[model samples]
Target: MTASPSAARGLAARLADGPVICAEGYLFELERRGYLQAGAFVPEVVLEHPERVTALHEEFVHAGSDVVEAFTYYTHREKLRVIGAVDLLEPLNREALALASRVAADTGTLLAGNICNTNVYDPADPASADRARAMFTEQVGWAAEAGVDYVIGETFGFLGEALVALEVVREAGLPAVITMNLHEAPRTREGTELPEAMRRLADAGASVVGLNCGRGPATMLPLLAELVDAVPVPVAALPVPYRTDAAHPHFQALVDEAYPGLPSGRPFPTALDPFTCNRYEIADFARAATDAGAHYLGLCCGAAPHHVRAMAEALGRTPPASRYSEDMSRHVYFGSDPTLARLNLEYGRTL
Candidate 1:
């Protein structure tokens, strides 16, 4: 199915129909594919390897993503300057948005322009706010010109910064999905409570407001429960697909005493293999998130195509990817069919 530019439904219209599955975690997924850098986290691949970006977007859409978000997570000017690639800033943003637009049109998915934490906001220094706003405005302008269905401002650690992002999206006259990222404190960096922070974003005209990144499903759900009751706007919850607990509420804070010889003294970016959640855990999270009143559901950071498929299935929808979903009953040793080899079936227990 194809949705022409005039035929595409907006983000709000889609949410009214049913749950919206947005596939994020492009940074981690592309890094794993050897097309991106982790520490820098810049999506230069959008310009360097357009096919790689296009393929990933197609994979996510086939896996049942309702939205095809542009890979502009860290494509802001600040991140580009950090790596001395500021020259590629505008080109990268335009390319990413163009790539996402094609996929969304082809797959009949909502296309979202993305702006994330600027890493430049500081309450003490008022100049920081201007810098952050400028970055958001430029990126959002490109998105508006590209004709995205909406804009998403995510992974903010401060209500103040998130408000700035919301302001930019509203200025563009596009629907806004604002999501915060909580640290171990369960509060914004400026010390406002999570629920209150979401209230502020919603009041500022965010179409959907809630939490993303930082915490895992276990840690993020309790927070989402608060937002659902406190904020009137639709709530969004996209947790990192990791087993984060109260003791280690955020994946970055997760430790592995089993491997003490680590390079960063933590298991965050590259070393979180042991902490990754399986498909079942992701399915469980999807069910729990809906129960908690979060209508905008997705996986962050460590998400994979299988995890997205599991989320879609948990929501009672089978995407194109479901055609390949596991059927262990058909295995040589696990099959119960009369045609199965009895010798291999009996050998399964002893072996």
Candidate 2:
């Protein structure tokens, strides 16, 4: 069967002429905003706050986001079962997609159905892969049926599992974007490098590939550079706020270890004090990612409306276009000052 017209405008097509912005947040954020009562990790926020969902959609659009992902991350049956809503999986997933589609239709922006990590990461068991594949297939199929423009499997920690999610989206005849989470060096917890991961996902039929939810932009760049060289498709980079306090050694250690040939026994660097970066920091990161070759840029966890606006402004000034394209050259900006690299390296070995 032919794909839907909206779906036909694949993520690559939509992002080809220029940069595309995507907002990332799970159902928990919606609940925090009083739009939901918190049933599961991916509760039915849309059912209760369709307007709020719509409002966020409108805000992103106003801020110049080209795509808004539906809040369906962790909406799979196994995840819902943890919260006693096992029976509501299909309905809830469908509803989330529908709500996103409605917002997209009303605002002329693309809607991407968000599918996140599986119930658990169990590489030793083939059953885990099987279950993940099945869940992803069902969820992607439902998203397609509900008329999403595309499907995004995000915050993935394992390449094996990410490939399973990619397969399901392809079988459903929808374009897919796989965004994985990584430690300081852009490797999975098991040490699969970001470049290798991106290559594998592209081979598995992911139309767009990127990173999300692990570390902020400061720590994400090394991996983003590797990804630009690894994949032929457009790369999207959505960095979230730092997961730990700025002074936390664990966070700093990740940054230190991600660079090539870093010593394993180096002393850890002192953590940088925390400071409010506001939209300026976000804009700087987006610009850096774009300069480093990210074709699609946006915000993730802890990112607010202003951050998205800053990204849009950065893109607007640099590209002067609104559609996605592949001919664009990836830009890289490495400064003479090595403060970031030095600090990151100092922390990299601590992990």
Model 1 off-target regions past 4 Å? Answer: 1-8
Model 2 poorest 10 in a row by lDDT: 267-276
How high a TM-score does candidate 2 get?
Answer: 0.77
- The C-alpha TM-scores of every prediction are 0.97, 0.77
Question: Which of the numbered candidates is closest to the native, going by highest TM-score?
Answer: 1
Instruction: Report backbone clashes per prediction.
Output: 0, 18
Q: After superposition, how far is residue 179 of candidate 2 from its true place, in Å?
A: 0.9
The residue-by-residue lDDT of candidate 1 on 1-351, one tens digit each, is 222352356777788898899999999999999999989889899998999999999999899899899999999998999999999988899899989989888888888899999999998999999999999999999999988888999999988999999999998999999998888898999999888888888889999998889899889988778889998889999999999999999999999999998898899889999999999999999999999899999988989999999999999998999999998777788766667798978876575
Q: lDDT per residue, candidate 2, 232-317, as tens digits?
A: 98897887644333333133344333344435332122121132236667778878898889987776655656667777776654
Q: Candidate 1: worst 10 consecutive residues by lDDT?
A: 1-10
- 75, model 2: CA deviation in Å? 1.1
Q: What are the lDDT figures for the candidates, one per model?
A: 0.90, 0.69
Candidate 2: residue 325 lDDT (0-100): 20
